[model samples]
Target: MARQSLAERRRQLTEAAIRAMTRDGVARTTTRSIAAEAGVSLSVFHYCFDSKQVLLESVIEAITEHYITVVKEAIRPRATLRETVRAGFQAYWDHVHAHPGEHMLTYELTQYALRQPGFEHLARRQYELYADTYTGLIEELGRSMDFELRVPAPTLARYLAAMTDGLTLSLLVLGKDAVPASADILDTITEHVASLVGDEPARQSTEVAGGTA
Candidate 1:
């Protein structure tokens, strides 16, 4: 269908933009490069996105959605809140390990947006979207476990955002060498999350190991 083709074209451009941004960095990624990466003409790229900013936003959305999906999938009802938290964090780390370039590109894009004056709002909105999604997950998990977070879910989400950013940056700098030591950080988070809940354990789900959420 024409509609499906149009959507596919847009998806292709978005993916191409992500690859270009990751490989070339924001400063060097131009419309022509992205169009070439997508195997489409510059006009087709323009048809999909009015401007580079729009394309960057689309790439951000895709990357963020993938992150949320993985984290949500990673968290499930477990024998203990600690295990649940560990699973989520570990899954997040796994995703970062698997897609280091995307993780790096995310921060690159955030910084790029921040420096663009008028486009700073895009960075803010991106983080807000992350915070909101993470907060909702925390609330849902808390309700399921009959335990509330020590801090507000939004506050905890913000804390998590900072933690993940640091962890990801470490990976970007140190590469795979950072993995073993990152366990200590994950352990600290698990202990903190465990402390938030009551003694009661959550009802374990039939499926463990964080099946798709």
Candidate 2:
């Protein structure tokens, strides 16, 4: 068999860890289990990661990367700020529905990281990553719309991140039947973002009309 490159082995092991944790629950997951899931020997597990904590950190990195990709696709350039924000929320919720296991594993790993000694930083770092991702998106939205946000970008991003976390937990517990109602909750958030933009859309329209006259 061909030898795997260092990066490939690490990626394989990390994915295996995520699958094992999702299947067996975080507390019950072990290096033995993760190695088995990766189709490698126990020594390979150690070779790939210094410790289980390191492995978990890799998992967090993978989760954060995936989330950024998901959210970027959702919030990609749109014709209007309102539509852009709405698309982001809708795309995220759709992802939750499509990959419930992945989302569930993220939350599970977060709680696990918090309770584990020397691992609490992972949880904090995860939220920081989330805030940064959303903040960038909001800033991009403002640039695309030719408008400025009334609130600081970081502040608004953190607020939206908190709302998403809460809403995700609620949806996970409430199941598919509750998605529609949860959407209404998202609409409330959208309205909040809209309020921060004030009359930028109207002002832009007036500018266009004056320029064309």
> Which has the greatest lDDT?
1
Per-candidate Cα lDDT values, in order, are 0.81, 0.81
Angstrom error of the Cα, residue 48, model 1: value is: 1.9
Clashes of each: 0, 0
Q: Against the true structure, whose TM-score is highest?
A: 2
What root-mean-square deviation over C-alphas does model 1 reach?
A: 7.0
Instruction: List TM-score per model, in order.
Output: 0.85, 0.86
**Tens-digit per-residue lDDT, 1-213, candidate 2:** 899998999999999988888788989989998889999999988888987777877887887677667777777667777777788888788777777787788799889889889989888887888898788887676666666677888898898889888877777888888776866877887788777764467677888999999
RMSD of 2: 3.2
What's model 1's overall lDDT?
0.81
Model 1 alpha-carbon miss at residue 97, Å: 1.4
Weakest lDDT window of 10 consecutive positions for candidate 2: 139-148
Residue 144 in candidate 1, Cα distance off native in Å: 3.5
Please give, for residues 112-146, the per-residue lDDT of candidate 1 as tens digits. Answer: 89998778877987888778777888877877766
What clash count does candidate 2 reach?
A: 0
